[model samples]
Target chain A: MSLTTDDVNKIAYLARLGINAKDTASYTENLSDMLKLVEQMSSIDTDNVTPMAHPLDTIQRLRPDKIIEDNQRDHFQSIAPQTEEGLYLVPKVLD
Target chain B: MTMHTKTLKQLSQGLQTGEYSSQELTLAYLNRIQQYSALNSFISVTEAQAIAAAKQADALLTAGNAPLLTGIPMAHKDIFCTQGVKTSCGSKMLDNFIAPYNATVVDNLNAAGMVSLGKLNMDEFAMGSSNETSFYGTAYNPWADNTVPGGSSGGSAAAVAARLIPAATGTDTGGSIRQPAAFCGITGLKPTYGRVSRYGMIAYASSLDQGGPMTQTAEDAALMLQAMAGFDPKDSTSAQQDVPNYSTNLNNSLQDLKIGLPKEFFDEGLNNDMATAIETAVNEYKQMGAEIIEVSMPHLKLAIPAYYVIAPAECSANLQRMDGVRFGHRCDNPEDLNDLYIRSRGEGFGTEVKRRILVGTYALSAGYYDAHYIKAQKIRRLITEDFTKALESVDVIMGPVTPTPAFGIGEKTADPIEMYLADIYTIAINLAGLPAMSIPAGFIDNKPVGLQIIGNYFAEAKLLNVAHQYQQVTNWHQQTPKGFE
Candidate 1:
């Protein structure tokens, strides 16, 4: 039920976030407290119970394979940090 | 009387009778927003755009073709995207982001002819109970200085309470709408999940997120709901059911109405003053020929834990789009793709946001997936079943909106678990996907408390009727903070 320092690092890395070096100890404590809260669910045994993913319990609605969305690439890219020739510019993925 | 004190219906009639033009009314509210700038209620006031919209509305009025809300001025909770306007979800991450298109709710309000005053302030990513987490600043409660206008819809509630604007739009994933309404002494309704479109509204937790109205009276709330509700194919989760005219049954008699008081809501954690005020309000329901019965929702206490898991999990996935390369805040320089994402998200999100993303990531992480996430989902089913069974016997369930009246700003920030408990009363209804409301019930030590009414799924009209009948006899909702008047 407790999150060690390493756990916080791994979780933050998995979430693609960099934890402030100075705030790591505080993050560890906070996440540990939250886990304590979440751990309360262990009191009840929910074996064989159906997991509810939606409030209404309805299946995802399906539509035919067709493109109904209008292309707004230019408008969308207008707010991007880096875009060139209609492609979003990102750092190199490979050396 | 000055225009700000009038309700939406009153303002609508004024526009129809030519007593006041939309421009005049909009100008009055704009000035009031300026007057109360110390309240930190509004994030952006689109002065030129509001004036232009007012002029067009006046032309419609002159031609005898004005809609119900043609000239009325209100604001959004900043979470809803508005075209060409900044849609900061109270975060530094989206501080520079401008939405290219309007959210469905925004478009709906525009089509209804409601002139938007501007965007309101809120907790970053709708994560916190108090507005202190806002990147801009906290919104002060108009009722009492230093007290929080309970959030994440804190600004909307305070603005309406101060008569700066008649009403505004607010979203509730948990208690974001109802809790603030209770604290600010206004009427707010969170309709059944999917009752309103979420196409342009920023996502918090998709399954639990819903948009509703924050107004002074249930009638005004009904009028706002009429404009904002209905099906939108764009939102896959939007209800396919039709939105009934919410205002049509405002006068429905409460005779023989079966009301249930959930015993769990009145337990030890509730403030004594809150209990006294809620019960006194229930007595008024009895006076109106309604019957009250006690009901128990045993799994009620599980809501907060279940929510911490589900909400953050959903938020983690939803907020993953905030990478440096796209629409939101980006880092200065990136060594590589991983560096861009890490620094951008790290520097972009606030502490509370980072904590949630971390919690959510851990919950959905490889080893802990079934034990944490699945266990929480099964617990969600139990809590939903509790509400379903309780509602089968009662017309509606009544309770206090919060454990106590609004707390002083920065009161519960240090301890996050203590802050999470503020949602104890309001979170379960969302788990059930039922429509619920919070109407001004009474005051405690000069602070306001709201009476919560939870109804069966899609019972917005009945909830409004119940709240409207109470407003008929009591004048609590009519009480305005002294200095503001």
Candidate 2:
């Protein structure tokens, strides 16, 4: 499963990386080589195998879903690139 | 005394006796930093803050209130968050990012009264094996200026090896700590997955990323580990177990202990020099009354494939928090919402980072998830089971840390596959989520070979004892890189 140029463009778009057509050839080549290497898993017999998510196979202990801590919205927003009215401001999407 | 040559014990002893103030020790290291600027080991040095903390520690000591590690100077890999300090993680994404809080390990170390030397350089987001991927610059091996220092913890290993600091903290995802320590001729350990809290330590692969110590000897690693390990409520994955006295078992004899030699680890592609050094070290253990047995880990071949998928897949999600909006570098021109994402990420991330994000995106993309991402997770279980079987027969597993000694700068940079192959021996340990260490076993062609000692989960104390006993009988750990002295 080699990545086509269209696939590279779509992946870059999803990843939010600005990969243009000029560099798509190189990206395609590199991604394909890496995928080829990763593709070795296809030959393995994993029919009865269960996927292990955590290193230690244990269910995560969850804390009660409660807002115990105070929200320092103003303090946190002080470091944002562009924030106004306690909201992160980006370019207008609908406009 | 130079503080660089002094072990943690010696530094602690000096602090207790009032031989020199913590300020003086920090100054000694700072002076060394100025002298060894060519090595490019440190990313940021908080001279004023370090001195102020040292002075405060001295006051506490004079008032008969000193902790176990009062005033000892050490540095952290830039990956660990330090309150109000710029924790760059050696990437441009967080170049201007000042962490609002200290990582759990940093808070614990500060509580123990250790002084922060600075933030050490590392590969960008702790991704690459060599420090070459760092946005700041590549870290030079103080041992041989021409060769590369192994990464992504190259800066910490180089700093310790060059005697710039007594010890430093490092993170090992896939041999980031051990390989660098091997190349720089020092001691480095990666504790079991949950042994150390990852809270505030920037996540690479949450499951595999473990914070440990890189020091001059196994004893120093034990002392440092005492402060680093603990369960933290903030990090959900942190184990809620008591951290044992790692130093207490330092004097335990390795006699009658069983060491496992994995047949696959010693097979083809294993460099003759590294193989010889490992075998010689095993023979030394035998002479010391230890039994060696052959072990097998059949899933070894799938480790790199499994790791590439799982690590990148996790990394993609982990790094999403680094977008331009929060804090750090942001692009000037933005066309729209999509442009903001593209421009910010493109300008912020380094080449290796972008490469990983691309690979990760494809793996987790629609129609390919089962073939790549999920299958890798399935194989991860097989690798862990292999270790469990191996450990049932032996006290610890021993092998070479890397196939070859440190290579020259730009030697394999152009060929990414070649560079990835360098991490083959170390990645398996991360896959199994086991505790492992790289101790200076012997030298090959004037370069050092690290004898990797791996233990089952939560077996750091046993691994340290094995390395410590080896150090007692052998002087290999004492060898310093040339010109460092």
Candidate 3:
């Protein structure tokens, strides 16, 4: 299986990680090598197989919807890369 | 005696009788940690925090109300979140990351009066078989300075093995805890899925990641598990069933016990020394009156394959939250929104982590879901069924933790496939949602080999009982690294 530079960029795009043209060669080889390993899955016959999303088949249990934590904003935002007014600041995405 | 030689119960008793204050015990562990600093076992030591907590625990002991682990010192695998402490997860991406809240495991340990010693190093995002992938550097095997301590919980295992700390918490996604414990010659357990809460443990294949204890003995692992286990509303998948006293059956006799030896586990690739040591241990069990049975988990070959698909797919999704926007690392220059996402993640994650993300993204993509992801999930069911059937005829399944003992630091780090193969015998337990433990069985060429015990769903007590009984008759777990002390 061969992944082109375009494919690597597309996968990165979908994954929400940016990758440029120059890094594509290394990404291509790595991704292709990984796919070859993953290809081993194709050999196993999985007909009528039920996908297990969770190890246990139990449904989500509801909680009391109570606020058990308090006064953690200052403690939490203190670690953010960029923050102000109890919120994290990020690069502008708007026009 | 080394502070690490004492079990949780023994330490609790000492605290109760005023034999030693928590502060003194904390200082002893701190001194040992300093003595073994060359091992690179601890990433960050919270000395002030640990002493303060120990003082509080001493006050509780003075009041005759000491908890199960009151004043006992413990270490956390780097993956677990500790409020106001650096949580690198052995990755450069989170090098500067400081968790805002304590992980559920950390919270529970503190509640039980256990003092935090420090954060232990791990594989980058808990992704490797050896600790070499750690961005900080590889943790030295305290047993042999030239070799690696198994990973991604290598540091925790080393700390316990070197007698630096009594025990430490570890998270096993795909054999992280067990492999390291086996390599470092300590006991480590990964409870049945949902038995321990994962609220603050940094996500690594959320479906497979589980937090458990790595300690010098099975009984100590039980006490640590008792405080760490049980349901938490914060973790949706936590089992609602009552947690039994894990120590309740610790000293039980293994007579009439049925131990299953998986034939597939003894396949061609297994190292002869490991095989011999394991067989000797099994013979000891037989001599002790436990019956041995040959059990087959036919789909064993598919475990490694299925895990690669499912774990990476889940990891791809779990790690997306680490982008620069919310917290952690960010790029210096951001041309646009996309550039911020690209530069931050591209520069933050290591090569192996990025590779897994790409693979996972490819597996979960629309065209590949049924062919790759769904197929792996289907094979996963068969893997679980194999265990269910094997357990029906046997009380517990026993096998080699890894095909061989710990390899050189960089031996398997470059080859992803070889690294994946290291977890062949252990990943099935995670897929099946069963509790399993790794205990020191014997040595192979002076390196420790672990005997794996797999129990039915939520059978941690029985598993510990089997391990404790074996430990009573054997002294493998007591052998410490000679020069480290």
Please, what are the lDDT tens digits per residue for candidate 1 over residues B98-133?
A: 999999999999999999999999999998888888
DockQ of predictions, in order shown? 0.89, 0.76, 0.69
lDDT of 3 by residue, A3-89 (tens): 888888888888877565676788888778767766777776778778877888899788787877787777767777888888877
Which whole-number lDDT from 0 to 100 does residue B103 have in model 1?
93
TM-score of chain B of each: 0.99, 0.99, 0.98
Better of 1 and 2 by TM-score: 1
Q: What share of the true interface contacts does each candidate keep?
A: 0.89, 0.73, 0.78
Q: Write the per-residue lDDT of candidate 1 for residues A1-95, one digit (tens) a residue.
A: 88899989989999999888899999999999998999999989999789999998777788899999899999999999999999999998977
1 against 3, candidate with superior TM-score: 1
Which window of ten consecutive residues has the lowest lDDT sum in model 3 chain B? Answer: B1-10
Candidate 2 docks at the CAPRI level of medium
Model 2, DockQ value? 0.76
Model 2: per-residue Cα lDDT over A1-95, one tens digit each: 68799988888989988765677888788788788778877767987889988887767878988888788787667667888877898888895
Q: How close to the true structure is residue B214 of candidate 2, measured as C-alpha lDDT?
A: 97
Instruction: State how far residue B77 of model 1 sits from its true place (Å).
Output: 0.7
